[model samples]
Every structure is written in C-alpha cells, then in structure tokens.
Target: MGLLNSLINSFSKTPTSLSERVTTLEIKTVCLGKELPDLEHLILIKDRFPRREKIKISIENETLEEIIQIADIPNFQQYQNFKNKFFDDELEVMITIDKKVEDNKFSIYCFDNFMSDFLKKETSDIMKAFNQLLKLNNYLIFEIFDSSLVPSLLLSTETMVFKKADEENTILESDRLKKIETCKQNSNFYSNSNLELIPEDFHIKTDSNSNLRNVFEKIETLLSIAYLSNSAFLEKSSFKIQISGHRMSNYECDINVQKLKNKEFYEIYKWTYTDGNPADKLIIARNAISLHCKNLDLINIDETVFASIKSNFALYQKENVMQYIDLKNKLAEYIVKLTTTSNDMIYGLFDKFKNNLIAFLTFLLSVYLIKIMSNQSVGSVFTKDVTYLSFLILVASFLFMIIGIAEVYFQKNKIVNGYNELKKNYEDILDKKDIENTFKSDDLLKKSI
Candidate 1:
C-alpha cells in the first residue's frame, strides 16, 4: 500500500505527454428500411458528409449498381422496396441486432490515413452533420487511441479500499496517514472520496499542442454526471464518488475555451465496464459544439464546459445587462412623459387661440349685419349697441382661453413634478445631480407652462 501511494504521488507532481491517434469514427443510428433514402437521394448524402474522397453507398439491389448522380437513378424510389435498405445480415458492425426487421439499427464506419486527411477543419463539418443524423438522441462515439497515465486495468480496483489498522498493521497505516497528510497540504486537493481530480480545467489550446488526457477526464466527468443515478452501473464500480442529487464536487467545470484540436478521447476505463446511456443529449451536444468551435476557429473550448456555461448564462445576462436596461427604461419612461406634457400644453394653447379668433370674427360679422339692417354706420354700431349672441361670443372666447391656460398649467405641474422625483432617484445611482441638458434655465423641467 505504501509503495502504491508513492507511485500515485510521483505521477501527480510531474508533467506528462499524451500521444493521440485517431483510429476510427463510429456512427450509430436507428432507421427503418423506408427511412433510408432512395439511391437518387442517397448518393446526395456524400455531398453533405465530410472527407475529400468520394463517399461510397452500399445498397444490395440489382437495379442500382453504382449511383453517381441523382439524375441517373431514374424513378428508383417508386420501384425500390424499403425493406431491403438495411437487412440485419447486411451491416457487419451490428453484432447483437434484433431479429425483427422493423426494429433494426446500424452503424456506418469510415476512415482515412491517420495524418494527411482526418484532422482538417472539414472534419468539424462532418461532426455537425453526424449530430443531425443521430436518432433518438443516441450518440456517435468518436474514438482516439491514447496512452493512458493510469492504465485502464487499475481504475476498477483498490480505488478507496481501506483496512482496519491494528498492532500488527500499525506501520502500513502510519505510512498511509503521512502520505495522505502530504497530499492534503494543498487545500481542495483531496476529495472525500478517493478520486484524485486534477486542479485546472482541461483545454486543447492549439491544434499543434494540447493535452489528450484532459479530453478523457472531461468525458469521464460528463459520464459521471449523466449516469451517476443508475444503481446497476454504480454496483459495477469499485468505489463510490461523492454525490448529492446530481454529481457535485469541490472542483468546477470550465467553459471558456471553445474547440479542441483533437476529437474527444476517453480512457478505456469506461469501455471495460458498461456501455454508456443511449440517449444523452449532453454528450451529443458537446460533440456537435466541439466540431462547430473547431471548424469556425473562433475560440477553443471543452464541450462539457458549454453545459455549465449555458445553464448559468441566463442569470449572468440578467445581472450585467438587465441593470442597464432597467435604468434606461426608467429614463425613457420619464422622458416620454415629460415630452407628452409639453406637447399637450402647446396644443391646448393653439386650440384656445384658434377658438378665440373664430369667435372675434363672428362677433364682427354680426355687428356689421345689425348695423346694415338698422341703417347705422359700423363705428357707431360697435360703440353703442351689439346683438346678445355677439356679446356672449366675446365673453365665451375669454373664458375658453382662461380654461385652456388653467388646464395646461395643471398638467405641467403634475407631470413635470413626477419627472423631477424620478430624476432625483436616478441621480442617487448616477451621482449626476447638477448636470445640465444645455437649453439653460428652461431646462425642460424649469420651462413655464
């Protein structure tokens, strides 16, 4: 146990290099025979898929030998039977397939020489396309062969195994205690469960230089997140990781970097035990985002980190941007109110002036009519006598003007005061009490009705 502790400690303190070889890209999808497109449509798929080399479509039908273009197939969909598209015996990879023809699934395999072709930017497009191709959220696993630091064989055993220390076992226990103490010297280093989580977030910084082990560790973290609840899977594990409702840790997942240079690589520790859950949207989304981030080269990131980043994005957005929006909205609301009050005051003044002008003109016409009818001169008619209606018109015009002025004053006092209070409150935060809007004392607020 003491020697084992030493090996683990030595590995932790140093830098290690991981060599990656992209071995195989495996695609799994569930489709009915009819779901498979006709040869005419099928030949077009290669156009959508990646790889510079031409895609070969394998269909066991006598009518369509080799499909080069959709134009040549000529009514293939009308005559061809859907059942023959992926017969259980046809696909070599589906070893344990269902006997029923209706409930069949298949995997498509393709590869090129390890170096010259597979790692280019177009592979990113291919991953995005494959994500759409996946059915029922079943994942397409991308495998990269790696030299693991902890051999896949060791993870299943003795992870958290402990024995009672007695008089006979005092020496071994003391050695364990001392080594444990040394590791714990750095706070947050040791998990209550014996899993040794790395301190920093994983990043594949550049295509030329990046860590592959981080890739595996991240996937392992995701798988643990995805399937920690399945009791059957837990029983298979040798040790228990700390858990609450979802997998929780003292460590945090990083969301900064966007794309990885290499496809996701996980240690064979998972492959040795159980196949992961079939429909993990979390895993599927990560695969697509990694590809997207890679193709665009806008940023480099780990895919799983995106989940944490997105989950908390709404709150972060509200915190930073919403405050500004609220302040601006309050400012806008008050400004609109102030502008409406000024506009209404001007309109009321104009309306009152127009009404008075009409009334004065009508009084003059009536006075002239009465003077002509009674045979009196215009100057005498105005000074001595006028009709009752003409007199009422002059009095009403003056009253209307007074009422309009009063109403405008009433509104100016009400709306402008509200705006002042709002401005004062806002100034508490902005600290800009004495700032001017530059039209001088008629500062909109100080302007008379």
Candidate 2:
C-alpha cells in the first residue's frame, strides 16, 4: 500500500522533500530489456498510450514521471518513449529512452530552479561533473537558468557538437566556393596554383616590423578593419541569427580541420544570440568563439562579449603601465646613486665650483699673512675693493651650494617615496626583500632594462 501510494503521488508530479541531502543520480535517456542496479523504485513506460488507465495520452508529448522500482521492464526496445525513475536514499532520478529521433540528447538542470529538489546541487565545474553522463552515442547538456528563465549556460560535449554538425551537414556548395574565391582574391600570397583558400585557414601575412607582442595585436586590428569595412562597430549589436545544418560540401581547406583539433580550449562550448549547427567550417571548428552573455557556470562567461574584451584590454594596459613605471623608477634611483658618494658628497658641477672657491680663498689668505710678516704694504694686498668683492663671491658660492643640495635631496626623496608607495599598494605582488632591492638591481628583465 505504501509503495502504491508513492506511485500514485508521483504520477501527480508531487516530489517528496529531501532536506540537507545531496547525492548524484545519473540516468541515460534510454534503458531497455533490463533493470538498473540498486534503485528503490522504477517505472518503464512502454509507450505513450492513447489511453492509459483512463488518462488521455493521445498525442506524444514530453513528460516528467516518477518510478517506484529498479527492475528493467520486459520487451522495452519497441517503446516509442520509455521513462525510468528511481530513488536511492540520497537522490531521485529518471532515465528517458526516446527512440523517436536519432539525435537523442538530454538536458540536465544543475540548479534547483524551484522545480525539483533533485537538481538543486552545485559543483565547481559542470564539464567534469557530467563527463560520463554521455555514453554509447548518447550526449547530454548541462543547463543553468535563473529565476527569470534565462539560460546562464547551454553546455554540451564535443561529440554532441560534431554529431549535430554532421546531421545538419555543411553550407551550400556555391557559398563555400564563393568564400574560397574571396579569400584567394584578397590575399596576394595566393598564386594561381594556390587558389584554394577559406576563411578558417586564411591569415594575414606576418611582417618583420611588428614588435614583441604587437604581431598578434596587429593581426587582430587588420582583421577587424577588413571585416568592418562597410559597417559601424556596434551597428548590428541587436541583430541575432543562428545557422542550421545543411547539405554537405567542403567549403574550407583541409588545414582548417587540423587547426580546430589543435586548438587549446580554455572554456567549454558557449553560444549566445545564435546557436545550433554552424553553417561555416570555421564556425564549426572553433566552437567557443560564438560570443556568450551572462555567467552560465562555465569559465570566464561574461554578461557581454564587449565587457569581456574591455576587461582584457584593461588588464593589458595595467601591466604595461607598471612595466614603464618600474623602468622609470630604476633610472631615477640609478642617477641618485651615481651622483652621491659614501660621505654624502655629490660629484657634480657644484662640487667643482665649491673646491675652486675654497682654493682661491686660501691663496689670498696666505698672501696677506706673508706680506704682514715681511713688513710689506699689507693694505695693498687686502684692499677695500678686493675685500668687498671676495666677501660677495663667498656669499654667492655658499647660497648656490645650499640650493644645489636642496635640489638633489628633493629628487632623491621623490624617488624613494614613489617606490615605497608602489610597494605598499602592491604588497601581494612583492616579496619581503623587494623593498630594499627594487632600486638596486641593474640586471635586465625580459627584454627590459
């Protein structure tokens, strides 16, 4: 009676509340001719019956059902759509085996979505979480949506993407040939013999003039200019389109296939605005370039693609600014060290002037002393005119030395203070000993001095 009541309630779509419990329940879309292991309950819906137990199932419709047994139903292969559900102590799950379409894919909602308690669980990485969910020509997508019913992510496996592309096939033969012709015509490097070219394999020739990191940057700039030759930057911001599968044709070079396979993907399949089977070979090859909007559990998902590009630019700007500042500070500190001595003496034009002034004063004093001792005319040697001029010269030299000293100290303090402030603000990026060594190092850093 208890089991029968559970089944009756399941048919009504009422889920039992399981609080503070999270367990993984994985189920394939189709399981037939046998039962799953270690399940408390199961249901094998043979087909969408026109009338099953007084319930109208006239038209085939997608459904969510609950099962109370684990054993596989007998002769489950011929069923148009079969659903199996079971509850272990931790999770309640169901498997839908729909043979209606050859491309039988499933969607697993990772969030609770106020729908059921089962999908409320969380994981760091969705790709790793459902790696094995797709098996035996079967594939599943992990989707996350918010309260507003907007998808945060629509992720799937590589196999799922390739198969979808295969189903949809390729673009029109004329379209492929036209794109190839455009590529060949635009690039001067492509000769008559090397006529075949496609957007995926086409690249701007690299120049020797490009600086360290500027080569890639220049390529990006040129590509953008060519693509946006007639259109404004954000002119079609609101336009949206998704290309579907098509008849087969080789629109791109064979090299494009290898390039796609060799790509290092930092993130999973991402799509926004437009999705489904790609119509272009390049689009089909590099899957993640399809811009995404909003955080969808995948890595680096942003609300706007523009926002993502802006963020990357900002990071690069910050890094370059720091490098320039670091180099400038080192030069300032070097000047301070080179100009000053161990005894706090600065070796410059001012020092030379001070030494020469002292020597003249000493010579004049010696002459005056000798003339007085020999009973000579001391008044002539130490005349009023000479005395006044010597006094003025002494005062001027003293003032100049004071001003020079002040200027040197001001610049030295400025350099030291700047380094200290930068180190304090970026403490996490520096080591404990970096404060003392920043200005002292003369060794070059990665093409920088």
Candidate 3:
C-alpha cells in the first residue's frame, strides 16, 4: 500500500506530455462505383512516411467490400493490433493519424508542400471511397468539411477520449476561489441571489455607457454568478461579455457549473478566431453581446447603442423615421407647455374678436333694411337722419374693423415673437436642462441604434 501510494504521487507530479505528434485533415469525396478505385497512388505517399508511425482505419459501413478495401490499406505499428476494430461494419470510414500529441500543442500544417501534395491525392481517394461507401444509399450526397482539420481531429468523436480528473488535487486551477471571494466582498458586482427581489423602485437608466461597462465588467468580475440556483430572477439579470478584437471569433459557448454547492460561480470563456480582422472583431462583439444577454441574462443595454444602428437603417426608409419624429414631437409638446402659455392666451383673444366682427356685419344689414321700409321720402331720409344713422353705422362698422385689424396684427406679431422666444430659450435655457429633448439624451441613445 505504501509503494502504490508513493508511485501514484510520483506520476501525479510528472509533467503530462503528449503521446505523439500527428497532423490530420479530412477529405469528403464520392467515387462512381461499388468497388473503390486503387488507393495505391495515395498509399504510396503514406508508405513514404516512417514505417514505425502508426495509422488507424475505422470504417462506418459494414459491407464486405468496404472491409476488404480498408484491410488492403497499410497500418502503422501502433494501429496494427487494432485492425480488427475497423471490421465492425458501419457506413462511415475514418482514417485517423493514430499519433497522440499534447492537447496544448496541437498543430495542423496545411500550407506545407508535402501536406498539399498528400491532400491532392487523398482528396481524390476520399471522393472515390465515399462513392463506393455510399452506393447503397443513392441519395445525392454532399459533403461538408470543417473549416480547419486540426481541431476536428483533436475533438473527433472516435479518436479522442476525455478523462475527468479523478482527484480534487488533480483538477486544473479554476476561477472558483476568486469568484467566491468577490461575492463575499459584496461589491455589488451583481445582485445577491439571496436577495431574489429586484427592488421594485429600481429604474436602471439604459442611457449610461458606465452602466454598460458595469454590466460587462460584472460578467468578468463575478465568476460565481454562473452557479446560482435556476431562478427566473437570476435568469433575467443582465450579464455582458464583450468581444473586442477580430482575432477571437468562431467558438459558441454556454455556461458550465456544478450542482450541490451553496455558493455558485459563473465561468465565462469563448472560442475566438485565430485569424483576426476588423469585421471579425465587430462580429465577435455583437455575438458576445447577444450571447451574454441571451444566455446568462446580464447587462442593461441603452437605446443610444440601439439607435445608432437604427438611424443607419432609417436612412433608406423615410416612413421608418416617423418614430424619431414622434419622439421629438412629444418632447416638443412638453417644451411648448413650459415656454409659451401667454402666446396661447393671445391666440384665444384673437379668436373671440373675429366672432364679434361677424355678428356686427349682420347688424349692419338689418339697419339698412329698416331705413328702406320707412315712409320718409328718400331725400329727406338722407338729409335729416343721414348724419345720425351714418355716424352710428360708421362708428359700429369702424369698431368692428378695428377689432379685425387688431386680431390679425396681434396674431402675426405673436407668431413671429413666439418663434423667436422659443429659439432663444432653446439655445439659452431648455437645451442645457438635461431634459428629455436635450442633446444629452439624443446623443446617449443614438449611438446604439
């Protein structure tokens, strides 16, 4: 028992090294018949490699022809003992480079001359092999290869085996301890799960860049946020993961955590592109934002970020711009109330004066009818009563005219003056008020859309 314990300790302390170094690429091809053509041309290149290097063949099809063809192929010393393993009939053929390399140092050299030549030949062989392999299933078969061959091999279903660490001491250093420490410090990196109630009065301003930063920072800061109980409140919390550069895109990820722990933590990681570009950076950022909000439910995004993108779309469609107009008009309605109540009162006064002038015109016609119907001679009527009647009519008519003139004059003046007042106020007062219509809100929400 003592010797066994000592041996185990020694092995545990040893640096885990790669078992073998191998480069792998996949070829998907369809050949035209039941019998696959001679793969000799391809095998010759394989033969040129060191004979001691082991190559293994695994077939997906159970047909006798498929087995015969696979068996005819050369096997590496490492794979020689495993030749019978491929005889089990399946519909797929997987030829693996049976060399184990350390997970940390996996490399695929596609740009090399030898690899290029080998691929040229193997590409045809794979096509022919597929043709023979799929003769029974005459569906118009198409093949899709992975973008890179190296990672595919490393993660292949049949070729790779994942072994979880047996002992706690063997576990790789994780962010678990750090996340627990952050939660205990109570920095508000996030809401406490124990406090399930998001304060009802909590109205988070979606307008602050700092808010966005805080959300994203929280995702990175509280690693343990990931391990909480699956509550709806927890799911609704905004967590943000920012993907900044183009060099990191490609992998899709989800949060992983263990159950049964009183305190849980979130571990965030993503697969990014090795080849970096401006577009990739933008895509990464967008994808990260989407995933963060979508999956972990973290971060409050403001309209400014939303509108910056929206305005770009609106440039093509005028009708879509109505939303902006509506918002502005609403704000203008509030501004109108604040700046110009006296102007509205003046308008009301002008309206009343116009109504009185209309009634006075009706009275003039009645007076004229009364004069015509009277028994007085036309000349006398004009001579004796003309002065009084004319004076009275003239006075009344002139009063009505003055009122009309005054109403028009006041209306024009009010409009002009009111406009100037509004302009001056906007520049001097309301524009700086940090009100809804101020440039501050527009500037904040406009960037995102």
TM-score of each: 0.26, 0.23, 0.20
lDDT per residue for candidate 2 within 1-449, as digits (tens), equals 12222332333333332221122322222222222331223232322211111111111123423233332343344222233322122233342221111333332222332124422322111111223333223232222212232322222222222112112322211243444344333222212122232212212222222221222222222222222111111111111122121222111212112122211121111111123221222233222223331123112333344345335445645775696577567657745554453225345645767686787778688868888888889667877867787787778777877877777677656646654565565444344455347645533221121
Worst 10 residues of 2 by lDDT: 231-240
Question: What lDDT does candidate 1 reach at residue 152?
Answer: 21
Q: How many backbone clashes does candidate 3 have?
A: 39
**Per-structure clash totals for the candidates:** 6, 12, 39
The predictions' CA RMSDs to the true structure, in order, are 23.1, 21.4, 22.5
Query: Given candidate 2, what's the lDDT at residue 169?
Result: 29
lDDT of each: 0.35, 0.33, 0.33
Ranking by TM-score: 1, 2, 3
Best by TM-score: 1
What TM-score does structure 2 among the candidates reach? 0.23
Instruction: Give the higher-lDDT candidate: 1 or 3.
Output: 1
Q: Which candidate leads in lDDT?
A: 1
Q: Which residue pairs in model 1 clash with each other?
A: 257-300, 257-301, 258-300, 258-301, 259-300, 259-301
Off by over 4 Å in 3: 1-346, 349-356, 359-366, 369-449
Q: Write the per-residue lDDT of candidate 3 for residues 1-449, one digit (tens) a residue.
A: 12111221221322122121123433222222222223453355455433433444333333444442243455454233233444332333334443223321122322232233433432223223323322222111111122232221121111111121121111122232333343233323233233311110011212222322232233322232222211111222333233322222122222122121111111111111112221222233343444434434333333433343334333523542464455457557744553455455556666766766666565655555666798544555445564576668668767776876686567556645654454455442232343444434444223311
Q: How displaced is residue 113 in candidate 1, in Å?
A: 83
